[model samples]
Target: MATTDTQPKRLPILTFCAGHMAVDWPHGAFWVLQPPIALAMGLSPSQMGLMVALTAVGATLSLLPAGMLSDHTRRRGPVFAGTFVWVVVGYGLASLAPDFWTLTLMLAIAGMGTSAWHPLATGTLTQTMAGQRARVLGIHAMGGTLAEVFAPLLTGVLLLYLDWREGLALAVIPAAVVGIIFFQARDRLTVETASAARLGDLKEMMQQWTSKTGLALVSMISIYNMAVMSVLAMATLYIVNDLGFSVFWGGVAFSAMILAGAVFQPIMGHLSDTMGRRKIFAISLFAAAPLGFAMPFIGSPWVAIGFLIVMIGAFYGVRSVVLASAVDFAGKREGTTLGLAFTLMDGVGALGAFLGGWAGDFDLAYAFALASGFAMISGTIALGSTLAFPKIQAEPAE
Candidate 1:
């Protein structure tokens, strides 16, 4: 009989990471590409804004179910399978969509795919890496940041040569390929181990939520999401409509912000490991709050671009630290804890998005200012909570 090598495989991890990056690419691409779609479909600003809102709403609604499935099954196959089908079919349908209503439905389908990836991928990484959870998660999140950088630039180039429909349709090819790769890797993803008892996962997650550390981290996530989403959803519009920049250049500005995020996330993750969470966490949040408030004060387009880079860098850098803190507080129930924390925070962030959109309707500067205000409140909460929790040493890598 042939003996199978006992050595662990890295291909599965690579496949999972690449699949995530592929799907996220379109998240940023959609924002840059939406204007062209709106023009083609004759959608009003309110209608377009509602479409963006639905994307978040759909993702938010799906998180709980997705988390439960990943935890109970301890299998990522179904999650990967579901995400792949939806991305391909959803975007394919979007390409052929005849009107706004159909496009909305298609986007909601795509949102389900996007929603499924997070809990499952994060859970798998948490289990696989064991003691090295923070570093691994940081690496995984870097994929998202990198996608944010590439998506708009790629989509902008595609839009120049093709219409929006065809450009969207082209996304289907990569989705199909990744789906196949995920299926092949499914057997390799068998759960290596779990940190906590399955029966107590929910109770444990709930208990953590009440802890000062958990509450602080959750609050930090909420504020970070609000600030990030407000800028992400509106930055393209602000550049084109308010700053008198071309769509191409607007995409360039957005890419610059994500580029900064990509560089800083890993640095913050390393800091979280070496420097201690409380100090780094407090400094990042406090620094980001003021930068967020200063966003509207920039006078020229170039200055505005610089402000975006600084603001997004600080915002995303702190977010990386906050997520690492969640792993620290969650103890053995990292997956379930992360799911619950993300669900609560994202749910609140969804409300923030609606508020931002409404505020933007009145005035763009006013909307951003509202986001800044929320960030300040969240930073204050995080500062206090950090003092209450006990410091824990970083776990060793498996």
Candidate 2:
């Protein structure tokens, strides 16, 4: 039997963070790539919407199963590592897609890989950090923020010299190396193991979800993810095609939104350690709500960039706090709980992606306004959730 390593805790955590950095690039890369691909293929807005929608659906399929495996094994390395292999294959094939649908299908397959990453990583990190889960997850999540910040901008740079297909191939290079490293190092990553998942495992997790706090968190996660993902999926397209910006500027806008979140992630996460998830969670949604309405009106490129930074940053920064709340509510079976929560959050959130596309067809401005409505709704729901379950526990966000 292979035993886990007793190295400095940061070693494995940093290693895993590296893998996240590798995988998340493609997700961010798509924002920049989508507009060019849509124009090149003459794809409709609905088709673009379908691409993101199907990709999200593909991820949803595996999320629950992967979560179950991670929870049962109490080891996230294998699952974490395996996700990138899928990414390599999927992105590699995606670069060669012959048509719009083919490219969409390839990306959808890759979504399965992307979907598997978070729960295992976040769950394992939550378990690993123990008392400091929120703070470190902020650190780990910063890796993804870096990816979101760079991926779009990098892709824009690549496209200046290469075709979209070649650009995608370049993106695959990082995942291949990371996959090999992660596969070799997987077993050594920290996780407290037990028997595999059983029927009772689902049952027990279900019981937790039924609680006021759990249910409320689920709502917050689902609604907020829907809102944010909608923006991510369309921001570049909206910027370039609708707002009349250059590809590089579109990428810049997308990165700005995430950059703000990245900058704030560590700060807010550390604060949440004493502030409590609820206050931080609610404040983020509330603060971010109006930015959605403001999105369509920002015409000046510099102004638009600044607005995106604040809006996306406000919501995106709250992710670690919300996730920490989920982990606390989950107690021990964090991988499983996170899986279920994200499936609900991201799976349902996928529809918003499609809606972003569809709404854009009618009017890009209206689509943004609709996204704003979701944000406002999410803020309201989060506030209501706090009121309903005031005793859920932890430091107050206020």
Task: Name the regions of candidate 2 deviating beyond 4 angstroms.
Answer: 1-11, 74-76, 393-398
* lDDT by residue (tens digit), candidate 1, 1-398: 22232112443666667887776766767877776886788754455666776667766666656665665664556667778787787777877878888787777777677767777777767765755565677778777777778777777778778887877777566668878877777655655443434556677677767776656677777776776666666667667677887677777888888888878877777776776765666676567666557766867778777877777777676655666666676665555656665665556666666666666676555556666777677767666765565554342221
List the candidates' TM-scores in order.
0.87, 0.92
RMSD of each: 3.4, 2.4
Model 2: weakest 10-residue lDDT segment is 1-10
Error of 1 at 115 (Å): 1.7
TM-score of 2: 0.92
lDDT of 1 at 280: 69
The digit string of per-residue lDDT tens for model 2 on 62-170 reads 7777777767774556777789989888888899999987887888888788778877787777666678878978988998888888988989888888778888878
TM-score winner: 2
